[model samples]
Target: MKTALLLSGGMDSIALAWWKRPELAFTVDYGQLAATAEISASAAICSALDIPHTVLRFDAKALGSGDMAGTAPDPNAPASDWWPYRNQLLVTLVAMKAVATGVQRLWLGTVASDGIHKDGTPEFFENINRLLSHQEGGIVVEAPAIGLRTADLIRQSDIPRSMLAWAHSCHKADVPCCHCRGCNKHFETLQELDADVATGD
Candidate 1:
């Protein structure tokens, strides 16, 4: 069975990729987020797993791009979280890619704790999956972390500790802005994971 992953090189997505390696990865460049670490880290994860990777480019903001596109970034907050329906569009693109690659299963990193988008709702995923399935050629979207907390994802996965450091959580490019909510969330996830690991979990 063929599997595809929606990789953004962020901590959550990266963790999903590492957990499901050997499955090809799909990343998009929709003129939205410009963090180059996405390129490097995604490539590294793909290479490490020997899984083929593709970068698709689309003009995401061409449509009425409102707060979703230009949602001002807070220097002290998460710029990545402000994208306009980014997850929805990303999943749409993932469905397109799945059709092209003859892969029906698309795995994403939507943890129950990922409240930033749709509050990590099952209805959200079901809505998307429902539409895709009704399309001429159907694709299935699955979020393994549906009921999982960020800490649980890290604890259950076999991702290495070293690579964990490279998991980008910042919304900006170059260096990580530790103050952002995205970064803070990942930091919390790591902290919880480390605690679990220390306690022999």
Candidate 2:
């Protein structure tokens, strides 16, 4: 059975892909807060795993008309972390890819630590799968990271820390800010497990 994984090339997504058995990697290049850098990192991650990967370009700017497409960061949002309906749209795109690619199982890397959800509740694979099932295709979005913390994911996957050296975790900056929500959250996850990541220690 063929499986498709939504790899964002970040720690969580990379871990998800590395944790799973050999499968195809499906990464969405949605006009993210960051651009080619994220996609480049994601490609490298998948390549290292020797998995077939597909890059899908999603124009969120044209699709998101809601609060998530904020031209500016919300006071509530961490700097450069502005984009609405991103999760939903990404999952939706994954489902479509699954249908077209003949992939039966789908995976994502979402975790409980994703406090950036518009609802304050991270929509793990369960929620997205439920909604996706209501659609026509039989694709299911599975977020193995939902129950596991980032630390757990890192402990489980074989991807090296060096692979993460260039991930664009910062929203506007070219590299990790180490203070932004994404970067801080990543740091916290590694800290929880005492794993060395972006930090030297």
Error of 2 at 137 (Å): 2.8
Candidate 1, TM-score vs. the true structure? 0.84
lDDT of 1 by residue, 78-197 (tens): 334556466788888867877887886888888886655572578888988887778866777778777877666766777887876767766644466676666788788878877877
Q: Stretches of candidate 1 above 4 Å error?
A: 61-70, 73-80, 197-200
The true-versus-predicted C-alpha distance at residue 47 of model 1, in Å, is 0.9
TM-score of model 2 vs. true structure: 0.79
Error of 2 at 142 (Å): 1.3
Pairs that collide in candidate 2 are 68-84
- In Å, residue 163's CA in model 1 sits off its true spot by 1.9
Model 2: weakest 10-residue lDDT segment is 63-72
Q: After TM-score superposition, what is the CA distance of residue 158 in candidate 2 from its true location, in Å?
A: 4.1
* TM agreement with the true structure for every prediction: 0.84, 0.79
Pairs that collide in candidate 1 are 68-84
